[model samples]
Target: MCRNWGGGPLLVVECESDVSFSGEENIGLYQSSQWAERGFCKQCGSHLFYKLKQNNQYFIPVGLFDNCEGLVFDHQVFIDEKPKYYCFANQTKNLTGAEVFAQFAPPE
Candidate 1:
């Protein structure tokens, strides 16, 4: 829902597609019939995640974690598209739009 998202660090978790998370209250879920599902916390308006239904895999904003001690930064996608407002100090395999699609996009 937002671009050049929060200025703080974000944590992204990729898990097996069958996994799911349910919130007890103030939750929002949106989906398109065949591709993906999105969720958010309605009360606080926090973007929860984006899940690809075909694989049951989801991308979550890691800042949502209470404790993220084990997380590590490896590669970064859309590295070329990141706004000038932020920068990362760590060395990572930064990929541009074409590279990302080439590696992850399903064959056409």
Candidate 2:
């Protein structure tokens, strides 16, 4: 989806399931997995969101937001999966793929 995002880090926000927008019919829904769906704008094909149906969690692209003043750069997941060509200077908590999966897993 970086093609639509101009090839850089993508900031995002996690939102609840009930989030909605006006003219939602113009958005396209893509099935990314058994439990996840990716939404994009139909006209421009901009990557909009990645939604997990099991928990009704919507991971939204932060570029769409108007004000992000209160947000903080927290954890970076799948750090090991990132390409070696680029890196971030921020000293933050980083998680590997397995750790991210475990973090998102439901507690017993």
Candidate 3:
């Protein structure tokens, strides 16, 4: 399990069969076509990253890092799915689905 932030390798976490969804829901503007693999902490059973199996990439919820020291989000995914209950006040880069794909998608 890796825990470094952006500009480095993405964090990878293993998932268990007994995963649970809290219904907290994620807020962002990007969605991958692949299924998200979920996992929980062995000791606390807390919610962890939703690993994207297709590219061996993991999307860790910002909440998981209680006291993140140097981790910075490169982009906010699925912002359209963001709930109306809360609002993000940060000044980080925000990218929509098409914008994200444009940069990440393979060249023609």
Question: How many pairs collide in each candidate, listed in order?
Answer: 2, 0, 8
Q: Give TM-scores for every candidate, taking all chains together and pairing residue i with residue i.
A: 0.72, 0.82, 0.46
Q: Model 3 — which ten-residue stretch has the worst lDDT?
A: 1-10
**lDDT of each residue in 1-108, candidate 2, tens digit only:** 432344866667878887887889889998866667788999888888888867878888888999988987787777877778888888889998789667665544
| Reference-based lDDT, each prediction | 0.69, 0.77, 0.49
| Candidate 2 ranges with C-alpha deviation above 4 Å | 1-6, 105-108
Badly placed stretches (over 4 Å) of model 3 are 1-34, 42-44, 62-67, 97-108
Best by TM-score: 2
- Ranked by lDDT, the better of candidates 2 and 3 is 2
Residue 81 lDDT in candidate 1: 75
Which candidate tops lDDT? 2
Instruction: State which candidate, 1 or 2, has the greater TM-score.
Output: 2
**Model 1 quality (TM-score):** 0.72
